[model samples]
Target chain A: MSRRVRDRKRLEGYLPPEGVPISFSIASIGARFGAQVLDIALTYGFIILLVYAMVTTGALPIEAMFALIMLCVFLIRVPYYILAELVWNGRTVGKRIVGIRVINAEGRRLTPHQIVARNLMKEVELFTPVTMVFTVDAMSGLGVLLTLVWVLAVLIVPLANRRRQRLGDMVAGTIVVDNPRNVLLPDLALSLPAQGSVPHVFDFLPAHLDIYGRFELQTLEKVLRDPVRGEEPPDFGQISRTIIRKIGYADPVRPGQERAFLNAFYRAQREHLETLRLFGNRREDKFHSAPGS
Target chain B: MTDAVAEQDKRRTGSSPDSPAAPAPQGELLRSARFRVEREGHWRRLDELVVRAEKAGPASLSYDETRELATTYRQAMNSLSVARDISLDRALLDYLETLCARAYLVVYAPQESIGGLTGRLLSIGIPQAVRRSALPLLIGFLAMVLGAVAGYVLFTGDPGWFYTFVPPDLADMRTPEASVDYLRSTIYGNDFDAAETLAAFSSYLFSHNTRIAILIFSLGIFLALPSFALTFYNGLVLGAFFGMFAVKGLGYDVFAWLSIHGVTELAAICIACAGGARLGLAVLLPGQRTRRDALREQAHDAVKLVILAALMLVAAAFIEGFLRQLVQDPKMRLAIGWGIGALWLAWLLLAGRSDEKQANEARGGSAP
Candidate 1:
């Protein structure tokens, strides 16, 4: 097979397979819900406590205290989520334990800008006039009424979203996912060695297939291989060619420069693998380790 | 023998490369191994991988594999999650929007329902109860001090200002000779006509004093400066009047005459002023709370203190209008003034003790 055919086949592999369905179990949904609540509680709880302490101690007067508390709440909220996602790569302490993470609509890890955008929009979530009413009524008989309204707003988010995103999540271009327990086998293991480096190509899979399939493949590969090995492995060009040929692409280039092609293919594969390592590998203990599972 | 049989069974299961089942080993191994596919069209392979993972022990995936798989699994999970979330968002948004609109109507619209009004009123309870009561109490105390100071100053000063404030018919009665004649007549004659005339004059005095007090209290809205001015003017007038009578050697007699009703009446007016000042302060310096919020709080406090002041004013009116006339002797008036002042002070201090007692009872009852 020619290098051209192998490259085309690699590109073709990007398309989603037919009839591969996407679904979420009730349990998974519940887990996601639990994770969301936990994240909110952990992130916001400390700020609320701090404010309460300040007010109680008379270290801050009511007006100044409230302003400071709100500012702190706003500042801490988004950064908390962003840092957790970046460090844990999408999982908060709770999310990590529950084996779920947030990602963009395309099943990719969140960009830093995206994280900031989503987290900062928490201000929008809090932008209702009711908060003002509550503050105004704080010294009146109407305080209880305002408090009730505020509580209702806070509790309503998870119940309202299918994904259980509170108002903040809606503004953030992100979604939570259950970390798949299945392993992903590296592409090198799956690709045939006769073909040169696969061309850089884009593929649009059915959304579910892209998320679930990639997760499974990566998990499987990691399970089988020792990622810490020091020596370089054999060229994957021939395997790439074979896989391409099997996938039904025709060759365009002669096979005489197999060695040179193999070298290029290996280099590309290593780079791709490194990128995946940076963005992909999730810590198991963080999320998917359910009790008694 | 068991090994031989197992080997033969493996061969029969297409372990041989020539057999169709031979493809199953590679497929099974690939399937058993965990993998994440980032590229698009890998669904068939993904399905096969899923099948393999499922068939293999669930724990076949390594820790990293599990993390990678979790992402894909979550992606699939999110499809349903997103759909569910969208519907939930619509419902919540609708509910919140309705609430927001209702709040706006209650605050901005006049044609609100009684229930809505009540709700709005009730919302003020927490803030009023917690933070507002102080304004009225503080203002009331301050006003009393100011009124007292003014009264002392005026009564101890020259009586020139007294002539301006007292009606002409009443002014003629202030002369030293007439004052002595009137005192003798009141003691000796003790006639109904004299008593009636004195009662009428006292009524006028009571009404006039209460009106001035109310005016001073209400003027706080103009700002803190006005309140002080009104307070100071009342003080100056009182001082001048007192001073004139003292110079004339009639100061002790006048003090006795005034003390009976003056204590409660003056205290009540001062309380009213305090309440008004509190309201003004709320407007001037809202602090962290909004101006509206502060104003509402102060208004509540001021209203309570005003009610209490009105009650005190009524007490003072009764003493000045009727009781003073019944007692003709200066000595009797002095005794009555002290007695009434004591009673008023007792009432003020002890009026709310019952609430504390009730609260204690409730707490005790609930303790067990």
Candidate 2:
């Protein structure tokens, strides 16, 4: 391949692993959900504690206590979901910790309007009182039977959806997905080495290059250094060949000659530079750094 | 020179080049490069350093590492040609965080659902309270109304009975001639002009009624007896006033005049009283729950009712101050009152119904 073409290919972003299926274990999903809850609880808990302390100390009125509680609950819970979904990309405090988040069925960030629509359903959940009993004893007796109707009306709608969306989600134009692992890579800082003495050269890459190039470089670094630690190390030659094919390269490297080929190729460029210096009269040294120097 | 040659030899071997014999310059460069790469590689290891720093009291990550990670992520984002790819990356990060949050919830608070257990309780708890209180509220209102009417009729039959019911302080204000002239004059009597007097009277009555309603609702700590007594007394006075007028052949006119503001104001007072009664009852009979628990539950219901009461009072004040005064004809007044009553009924039943479907949708939707 021409040098320019190779450089162009190198600049391409890291390709996501195909067919890996970004499915998360139920345990992980639960952890993420829990984290969000904790975040809210902590936030609201602090506010409530502050209010309670004030009220008890007579710094605030008892009526203010009620108002404050109501305010905190509304402000914290409503915006917690909406803003987190919209801005934080669906992971609340707990969700962030557990490595799970909400996304569209197609695995995309939700819009603000969608977040608002989904959150307003909270009022419905607040106003309706009979729905909870339905869950407790759907099959027990006549009361249970009646409660079942109410429960069915509320809960059944969401169950019918492929994405398990409730009426609000449907109206709001959103879906919740398990936070896919690929999104976590950036936050995980997986591209950079975690610990070492060497000054990273990749940092010098100009910022104007698109995210794809940066990702590619980072991925290249990771792949080079980490190299998947179990079993026999992946045959770099075969792997490189497969990557090349996947990326639309036509030439294939032969087995057992991959390392020699790379070394010779780098060396040939260095020798070519020497030839340029010895024969062709270039005013200044044309080649600064030797290949693989 | 010997050491430099040895270091070069070591570099050729590539066997842990940080060996003691490695040349200072080469070793330093290699070490720094290796360190930088390793340091920048992963979040988990970086987090370990942070954790250690925290354990040791205070620590922070290197600024260079922070900047590098940020740049890398930004680059990844910019590289995406397809919105779908960027979305997927965002989704992955979101998922990871959510997983962490969910794990925390499971460990710390297993009971909370996305809608929250409090929300569930509110859904069931409020309506249940309302339904339970509805019978008592209706019965109490009806009984008071009937008692007032009965007392009015009996007292008017015997004019002397007025003194028995009326307090000594208010007795002198009554007219012996049994006239509408006296009541209208009393209502309109003031240094101000008739319009001003009427307006001020309406405003005073409207505010007084509201204050009384608020007091009844808020003084649940006193077991609500004061509020019930106040309701009963007001009802008796209303019945007596109407019965006296009916005896004088002015009952129809009086009914219209009273109802112009009475309907909403009375209803609001009753609602407030009902809220107070709920609180009192919760205190008196803490059924399956403890007193505090019952009080808390009752307080929630009472608050909703109080809000409803406040709305009604505002309607009452508007009618009393503007509508009632503008339409002096008794028939017109009655029609307006009835219209307001109908409007209130419609609202109580239907105001928030349009969003019911949306609310249900929300409940059913995924936690995302």
Report how far off residue B70 is in candidate 2 (Å): 18
Where is model 1 chain B poorest over a 10-residue stretch in terms of lDDT? Answer: B8-17
Q: Which docking category, incorrect, acceptable, medium or high, applies to candidate 2? A: incorrect
Fnat, 2 decimals, each candidate: 0.00, 0.02
The CA lDDT of each predicted structure is: 0.45, 0.48
lDDT of 1 by residue, A78-174 (tens): 4466566655445577777776656543333355434543443343244333345457645565766655665576557657654555433443445
TM-score of each predicted structure versus truth:
0.32, 0.36
- The alpha-carbon lDDT assigned to residue A21 of candidate 2 equals 21
| Interface RMSD for each of the candidates | 24.0, 18.1
The per-residue C-alpha lDDT of model 1 at residue A234 equals 38
lDDT of 1 by residue, B1-368 (tens): 11211221111111111122222344322211112222222432333334444334224566765554444443433322222222111222222222222221111211212345334333442223324356545655555456546655555453444665445564445543356556434333444444445444555555555545545554454454456566655555455545556665666776766676666666666665675576568668878877645654455445445545655776787676567657767788778887777875565554445455665699699966
Model 1 spans > 4 angstroms off: A1-293, B1-209, B354-368
Who wins the TM-score comparison? 2
lDDT per residue (tens digit) for residues B280-350 in model 2: 78778889878645665566566556556766886787677666657777778888888788877665554
**lDDT against true structure, model 1:** 0.45
